[model samples]
Target: MPSHRPRRLVAALVACSAALLLAACAPTVALNPAADANDPRCADVIVHLPDTVADKTKRETNAQATGAWGDPAVVLLRCGVAPIGPTAKPCITVNGIDWVLENDPASPSLRYITFGRIPATEVVIAHGKNGVTDAAVLPALADAIGAIPQQKQQKCLDTSDVTSPTGTPTAAPPATSTPTPTPTPTN
Candidate 1:
């Protein structure tokens, strides 16, 4: 028994170590991004545009979207005209995902579009130098990017409407109806 004591102690230590390792690698439950606004993993979404689109337009759109959504943030990374034509514009890749933008140079006045997902597909349209967007082509750009519905994408927008009010109102008294005198007494 004396000789086997050390062997038993070593086996016990090995068993404890194996248990601890398995516990550390246990599967974790998934959490929703919207419900878990404080989740560090869920950050703001960013969209990178081609070189042809002007800087002003990119800033305006990024600001607008960020103002609308309260939780997830939206940012514009780049804005410029596509070096090549609309169809041949180099695709911007993010997180191993590729985004295709139309860069039709024949209609240089058309807005340059970029697509991305902050958990939802976002289509960014940039006005050309002339400030005129190709109505027909612009809508298709959104379609090509497969933009999500406004309501669906709103979950990712940072809306500042939430705030704490300073003043508190007094409680109103409950209303009571007065009863009319009975006419039976006159009879």
Candidate 2:
């Protein structure tokens, strides 16, 4: 019986050790809440238009303009009209294009919209990748810009699968009608 007791004790210790090893190997999990899907604060951006798009003749003028703003970290040109929120201000206009400036100094949170302008030369600054931009605030900017008789909102890119390169066909399911049965009267 004493011999049996020692064996049982040894087996129990091995089982406990195995359980502890498995627990240590378990994957870690994050307990924090998921990020917000509709955060407006995420949108903030600034737009800078270069003189080339503005069509200034002299190279000195272009250099002066470029030097005036210093070198922006990220720039996107000739995309679409970025929307602007109420808080934003029209900072400057060069060659008929309006540039909106934002107050964020740490990093830009603004996006520029090319609106199909030719010879693309525009600069954009925003906080992080996928940061806020005039394009990001376009819904609100649309209403304000709409007040101008000449300005109209451009249609967004077609997101439908029809434009997909794969050309894969998707067939609609055939419709079926259920047959109605007449109830027999109980005798």
lDDT of each: 0.35, 0.35
Report the Cα lDDT for residue 37, model 2: 11
Q: What is the lDDT of residue 91 in candidate 1?
A: 48
Off by over 4 Å in 2: 1-74, 85-90, 103-122, 125-187
Cα shift from native, residue 147, model 1 (Å): 18
Could you say which candidate leads in TM-score?
2
Candidate 2 residue lDDT tens string, 1-187: 2568888999999999999998665433212211321122211111222332212111221121121121222323222233443333334433444444544445554534323222112344444653444443333233222222223442222335126566778899977798779999998
TM-score of every candidate = 0.20, 0.21
Error of 2 at 100 (Å): 0.9
Q: In model 1, how large is the Cα lDDT of residue 160?
A: 55
